[model samples]
Target: MKTSYVSNLAIQTAMRMTIQQNQMDLLKATQEQTTGRHYDVGLTLGATASRSLNLQREIDRLNSMKSTNSVVTQRLSGSQGALETMAKAAEKVRDTLVTYKGNDAASQLKIQKTEILGALQTFTAAANTSFNGEFLFSGINTDAKPLADYTATSAAKTAFDAAFTAFKTANSITSDDQITVTQMQDFIKNTVEPMFTGTGWDANWSDASSQNMTSRISASEVIESSTNANTNGFRMFAMASVITAELMDKNVTPEVRAAIGVEALQYVEQGIAGLNAERSQLGISESRVKKANTSIDAQLKLVNTHVADLEGIDPIETSTRINTLKVQLETSYTLTSRLQQMSLLNFL
Candidate 1:
């Protein structure tokens, strides 16, 4: 009887252990399929959650960079259009100066000069352009204005005005002398030329060497004299002066009149060339930004995929696992319950 009782008790205990073991196994399996925790659950969750947050932050950063790049690209396109227009205006000035057709030609030259000056002012304004209120062409100084106002009476313009005044004063000039033929020639060669070359007032301007302002003039000395008929300077400056002088003397000679017309055209043409070069550089920078955005996007996609793989559950696999575990646990419980009901007499 004792032997039968011991046998029944052993069966009951065995069934109870089986049920508990099955429950533990099911829990482990569920964790593996769903939560993916073969070891420490808390640590795994923390790591995965952290990684997800980091990936999301990276995506946001890339998106911001893309937005900035878009603004820069649009601005560059506008700059290119402005430069092309300036070039066309300059070409027209060149054509007028080459013809040298007396009063009619001089009149046309004056109109072209006005157009060229307007174009140059536009070009300078474009150089100081901003994207999202941030200056694009000021190099590392993104907040700094690339071009100071030439028309402003502020400290920024003082240096330029002072330099021009010095040259005029050196030539012994006041009022009318400040606007004389010789004075105009000197101002263009000394003041205007230096500003473009990034030597005088524009020395601190960004990308000075790359802009190639000085290279536009084939000969610096020839630009000052009216004798150099082959160079554009003789035609550009001399013609503008002649037109100004023509306001005083309508009988200005054909030779003097033609020279003035040509010089005005040449000056504007050079400005267009410089602006076009800057536009090209801006285009290259825009392309680089686009490439960077693409690269970052790719990286973000990769990280997100990794985070999903680490943390997310597969519903199909989890369901199958849960069903199997349920069956095992139920079988163990039934076996234990039957064993617990058994006695010595029943067992015999």
Candidate 2:
């Protein structure tokens, strides 16, 4: 009797263990069928597991880059458009100066001044553009505005107005005649350049951070995200705006206004050239970003193919496996249920 009882216990234990294994197999097969990937792909693929993992990781990285590149692309497109508009505005100013070589008529001067003011405002607004709360042109200083409102009583205006007045005063001291290119050169070197220097001017010549935004476009490549606002082109625009801003200043003598008008005709050409050069640079960077994105997407498609080959399972085969396991598990349960109760009479 004792021996029979011990044998019965052993049989029950083995049967239950088999049932547990069948349950695990059923769950695993079901999971594989649902996901269409091998449950133990690493073990199934063996030596190729490393390659699959690498491919998967590469795909993940590419996806991340694709996301960031989209944002950068938007910023570059907007930047290009804004810069192009500024260039046209500066060109219009040059054209106007060419045509209106005479006096500062209220209506015509108003039109020219309006155009320059529009360009200046556009430049500043573009400089302060933010995407995802990041200032696109502020370099590494993503949180700061790169330019101040030119009309405000702000430090930028104050510094510029003071410098222009000083230039006029210094020239007045030197000669009572018309403004000369030589005097303009001196004013630019001594007065303008110094004000733009670090310590002399309180207002930021440019509040843009010095560090350029960058991104890894590929496994082996990095690219700049956008252009900074501190270029010589920006300086030229500011200078043109300053000269144009004094169009209606009642304090200046007609000779001084005519002298400024004369200087403007020559200076605006340089501003247009500066804008074009910078635009070319931005165009180059934009081309590279687009090219890199194309390469990234192509590589991602190929890598994804490699990953699917290594880790993917056939849906039909997975479904069959799942069904077979379920049947086997049910059979085991039925067999367990049918086991006769142990009794002394049966043993006898």
RMSD of each: 12.2, 4.8
Clashes of each: 9, 0
lDDT of 1 by residue, 1-348 (tens): 354323666667777777777788678667767555333434557746666667667767666755655555565555456445544544544554454445545476567445434543554464555555655454444566655443445343455467656765877766532355554555656665555444443443333212211111111111110011112221232223223322222333445434444445466555445445555654665566556556756876886677567656666776787798799888877777776666657768
Q: Identify the candidate with maximal lDDT.
A: 2
TM-score for candidate 1: 0.48
TM-score of each: 0.48, 0.75
Query: How far out, in Å, is residue 292 in model 1?
Result: 2.3
Q: Candidate 1, which ten residues in sequence have the lowest lDDT sum?
A: 221-230
Candidate 2 Cα misplacement greater than 4 A, ranges: 1-19, 46-48, 88-103, 107-115, 171-204, 209-211, 247-259, 333-348
Q: How far is candidate 1 from the true structure (C-alpha RMSD, Å)?
A: 12.2
Give the per-residue lDDT of model 2 (tens digit) for 50-137: 9888888888888898887788788778777877877877777767666665655667777767777776787677667777788777
